[model samples]
Target: MELLQSADLYRRAADRIPGGVHSNTRARAPHPIYFERADGAFLYDADGNRYLDFVLGNGAIILGHGHPKVQAAVQAVLSQGLTTGSETRLGVEAAERLLQQVPTAEMVRFANSGTEAVMHALELARSATGRTRVAKAEGAYHGWDSAMYVSAWPDLAKAGSADAPAPVLTHQGADAEISRRTLVLPFNDVAATRRLIEEHAQELAAVVVEPVMMDIGYIEATREYIDELRALTSRYGIVFIFDELLTGFRVAPGGAQEYYGVTPDLSTFGKAIANGYPVAAVAGRREFMEQARPGGPCAWVGTFNAHAVSMAAMCATLQTFEGGGVWRTLQERMSYLEERFAQRAAERGVQVTLRGRGGNFHWYFTDADVRDYRSAATSSAERYRKFAENAAARGIWLAAGTLSHHSLTIQHEEDHLDAFVGCL
Candidate 1:
C-alpha cells in the first residue's frame, strides 16, 4: 500500500530521467513505482511490494513475465553474443515460424521496435504504390512514427470531425508538414472509410489500421468495415497495412487477420511476438517484401535489426503458440475476467461500457458504447485516475487511464483472477 520508497526514488529519477521514465507512457501516476523484479503475473516493486500486474508490459508479454522458455532462449543466445552484424539461422527460423502462423505474410523482415516496423511498412507502401499520402484510423495506436502518429489519441478539440478526421499530432515538436501527407479515418465506419478511401485513392499509398484497436480504449474493427476496407484498398492498388503491434500473436496465433478471416497486403508485428523482447517485424506478400531486398524499391538498413537473443525469444514464444493451447486459455481467462468485471460493476451499480476480445480489454467509465475517439472521448478520465490510485494501494497495477487498454497473461492464476475481481 505504501509507495514511500517509490515516491523517494521518483524524486531522484525526475531530476535525471526526462519525466522519470524512458518512454513517456511509463509515467503511470499517481506516482511511478519502480520495479525491482518481475516473475509470472506478479511484479516486485523497489519497495518490495508485490503487485498483480495487469499491464503485462503493455500487452507484449503474452507468455508472461520471465517465462522459462523465453528466458532459456534468450540465455542460450546470450553466450553466443548480443548481436552479429550478419544474418543467423535463428532469424530465418523466427520469420518462418511467424509466416507459418500468419496467413497474410509470405515473407518478413525483422526490426527492433514497433515504430520501426510501421515506418518501414509505410515506406514500402509508398514505394510500391508510388503514392505519397497515408491513411490510418483516428484512435488506433501504431507506435510513434511521424506519419502514423497523427490522430492517435488526438484531443477532440483539434480532431476536426469523427466521420472525416483531420490529422492531429499526438506529440509536440512533431512535423506539422507531415500532417499534409497523413489522412485519418473513423473506426468501425465502413461508409465513411470507403468514401474517404475512394476520394483519395490516387494519392493513398496505404490504409494503416489495427484490427483490434488498443489506444482508444480497445475499439475493434467490425467485420464489415475490415472486409470493405480491404476490398477498397485492393480496388485502388493501395496497400492494406495492419499495425498488429499490440494484437499480433496475442489475439490469436495468426493475429487479428486470422481472427477476423481477413488478410492484409502488409502488416507490422511486435509486442507479444517477442514476448517482451526488443523485436518487431514487417511482413507481407512476396512482391512487397522483396522490395526491401536489394535494388528493389526501398532501402532496408538497421545494424541491430535481427538481434539473435530477441529472435530466439520470438521463436520460442511462437513455437509455444503453435500448440494452440495458450490462445484457448487466453480466451477462457479473458471471458472469466469480463464476467467478473461486469458482475462487480453491476453490484456497485456502476455504468461501465466494456470492449474486448481474446486477451485485450478496457472498461470505459461511461454508459455509451464507444467506437472511435470522438465517441470514446466521452469516458471519464478523472474517475479512472482515482480508481487506479486505489487499485495500486491494494497491490493491483492497472494502466493509467480508463480509456487505456490492458491485457491478461496465461500466468494469471486463479488467485490473481479472484484478486482482480476483488479489486473491481
Candidate 2:
C-alpha cells in the first residue's frame, strides 16, 4: 500500500503534466496511483498492488477491463490499419449497432468526446429551431466546453440563489458572452423548469439534461419531472436533449431515455459507448440532425470522428452486452451492495445513505436522503473522502471523491460487501 513506484511516477509526471495527471478527476489526494495494467474487475498499480476496482474507469468499463471481445476487436483492427479520417466498414457497423440500441437515435454522428458531442447536439438544436438560448440543468458535467461548463462546480459565494442559480465560470478563459447566452436551472424541479422554459420559450433552442445526475451522487429524476419536461418542450416547440455520456450503456442498453420512458428530439452519447475509447455520438430525428446539413451552413466535422479502432471496440462491446446478460447481473450486484451498506451503518450507530438504481449509485455518510445537488452538497465530504482513502488502501478502488457512482463490475459477494461496509 506504500506504492513507492507510484509515488515516484507521480512526482515525475507532476514535473511535466499540469496536475501530474491528464484529467482533474484522476488527480486525487495522496497522489494519483500510476496504473500498470487492468483486467477483469481489478487494477494493478505501478507498485504492483492489486485493487478490486469499483471505479471501473468511471463506469465506462461495463464488462470489466481487458474484455476479451473488445481487446480482440481492437487488435484485429490495428493489425490491419488504424486511421481516423477515412470511412470504413467497422464505422458503418458501429453506427448501425448504436442506432438499433439507442431509443431516440434514428440517425447518428460521431465525435471525439462527450464535450464535442454535447456541443454539436446543442448547435444542431439551435440551427434546427433558429433560436439562440439553451437551458441546462445545474451541477451536470457535460464536458470542458464553453456552453455547458458554466456553473459545473461553482464556489459557494458566486453560486447564486438555489432556485435561480447564476452560472459561474469554473475556468479563467471563459467569456462572459457564453453565460449570457445560457440559462441555468435546478434539477428535479419540474415546476421551476416549466416556468423557466415558458419564460424563455421564444428564445430557447433546447433543454439539455442528464436523466440520471451521476456527478452529484447518482440522483435519479422522478417520473413526473421527466414527463413535465417532455410535455413542456413539445408544447413550446423546444428541442429536448438527453446528455447520456455517463449513463449511455451503463444504466441500460437503451440508455436512460429508455429506462425513464422519455424520448428526446436529440441526444448525445459517450463514455461506455466505446468502452472508454475517446469516442462519442450525437443522434436524433433526421430533420433536427439535418441542420449539420452536408451541403448546408452548420458543420460538425472532426478528423478522428468514428475512428476505426474505437468503432470496432464499440461494436464488439455492444454485441457483448446484447448477447450476454451483463445488466441483469449488474442490477443484482448493486441491490446486494445497497442492502449490506445500510445494515452495516445501522449496526455501527452510523448513518449511511445510498442513492440511484441498477449499476450506478452513491454512498453518503448522512441520514437524510439526497434528492438533488444542493441536498448532496450538505453531506459529509470529510468522512466520504476519508472512506475513499481507506477503501483504496484496503484493495478497493472507487471514484476518488465525496460524490460518485458504482460500476457494474463490483463484486456481488456478500462477504466483500460486509467487509467494505464494516470497514467504515
Candidate 3:
C-alpha cells in the first residue's frame, strides 16, 4: 500500500522517538499522521492535506481547534508571562471556577496532565484510607505510573479467565511487589465488584473507575451499577474515584457524576478541560482533598501544576462552553451522525457494533456487546484499520480501533456526516 507524506513523517519520528511517538497508544502498524496545524474541525497535514478531524486531538478539542475565545485568553496570559507555577492569578481564578463547576468538588488541585492528576488522586486516597491496595477495572487505563498501570492492555491468552482477569505488567523492571497491590475486576459486574471490594475492603484504599469507559468504546455504567458501587464503597469507607479525564467537559459541564447521579469521593478531569492544552485537575470533597498538602498527610507536589498558560486556557475553555451550549449542540449533531453511520452500516451488511453517547462514539466489530476491557479488546482491529485507511483517503479522519472517540464542533456538518455515510 502507498503511504501518505504524513505517514512518512511518523516513520521518521519513530526512528528518533521510541515508536516514533511520545505515547505508544498513538502508534500503529502503518504509522500515524503528522499534522501541520488544525483550525475548527479540520487538521492540516505536513503534506498540506486537510482532513475533517474526527479525532479532535483524541477528544480533547471539545471547543474545536483554535477557538477564538480560548486563543484570546491564552494571548492575554502570554502578554504577561506563561509560567507561574500554580501561583498566578489565572491559576487561582481557574481553580475557583473549577470548584464552582464541579458539584462533588469543594477544593481543587491542578496538575500538568491527566496521568499526574490520577497519580495524585490515588496517593490522596491511600493517605485518607490508610490502606495500600487500589482496585481498577481489568481493561481501564489510568496512566503509565507503576501503581495504576497494572492491566491496561493485556495479552488475551495470558490475561487469565474472564471472571477474574490477571494483572499483566506492561513496563519492564516494574516491581512485581507493587503490581501485587492493585486488584483487577471486571467492569459492569456489580456482583463481581461487590465480591472483590468485600474481599479486599480492609486492604483497599480506592477503587478508580471512568464513569463512561472512553477508550474502551464509551460503555456506560447502568445507574443501578453505579449506585451499587457507591453504596459498597461508602460501606467499606474506601475512596471511590471517578477518572473523568475523558468524560469531564466532553460528557457535560458537570461531568459524568452529575449525569449519572452517583458522586465519587474524588474525581480527575483533563482532555477537554483545556481544549487541547496540557492541564488536568483533581477535585473532591474538602475533607478528602485536604489530605494532599501542608494541611494533610499526603505530599502531592508538582512544580508544573497549573502553569499560567494552561490555567488561562482552562478558564477560557470553560467560559466558551458556558455560552456555547455545548451539550445541546453535541447531542443534536451526535444523534444525526450516529443515525447516518448506523443506517449506512446496515445497508452495507457490515457487522459492526455502535456504542457511546453524544459526540463520543465507538465503532466496533464484535459479536457480543462490549461491557468491559476484555470484550473491547476482542474488537475487530483489522476492519477498523481498513475503515480508517478508506476514511483518510476520503478526507475524513478517524482512529483505527474497534472503538473511536469524537468531539463535536459547528464545523462538522450534515454534509460531512453524509460524506462519511457515502464512504461506508
- Give per-residue CA lDDT, model 3, range 318-393, as digits (tens): 8766753877777778788778888988889998766656578777777877778877877778877777778877
Writing each residue's lDDT as its tens digit, candidate 2 over 339-385 gives: 87777777877777875565777877766667677777777988888
Superior by TM-score: candidate 1 or candidate 3:
1
Tens digits of per-residue lDDT for model 1, 1-424: 6788999999999989998998787886666889999998989998899988989888888888999999999899988875767889998999889889886789999999999999999899888989888998887778777888788777888878778988888777667788647889988988888898899899999999888888766787888999999899999999999989888876777888988889899999998888899999999888899889887779989988888888899999998887789998888888888888888889988777555766888878877767777778888888677677767778898887667888889988767877866654
Worst 10 residues of 1 by lDDT: 350-359
On TM-score, the leading prediction is 1
Separately for all candidates shown, the number of backbone clashes (residues 3 or more apart, or on different chains) is 0, 0, 1
- What TM-score, over all chains together, does every model reach? 0.96, 0.95, 0.94
- Each prediction's Cα RMSD? 1.5, 1.8, 2.1
| Superposed Cα deviation of residue 16, candidate 2 (Å) | 1.4
Of candidates 2 and 1, the better by TM-score: 1
Off by over 4 Å in 2: 410-419
The collision pairs in model 2 are none
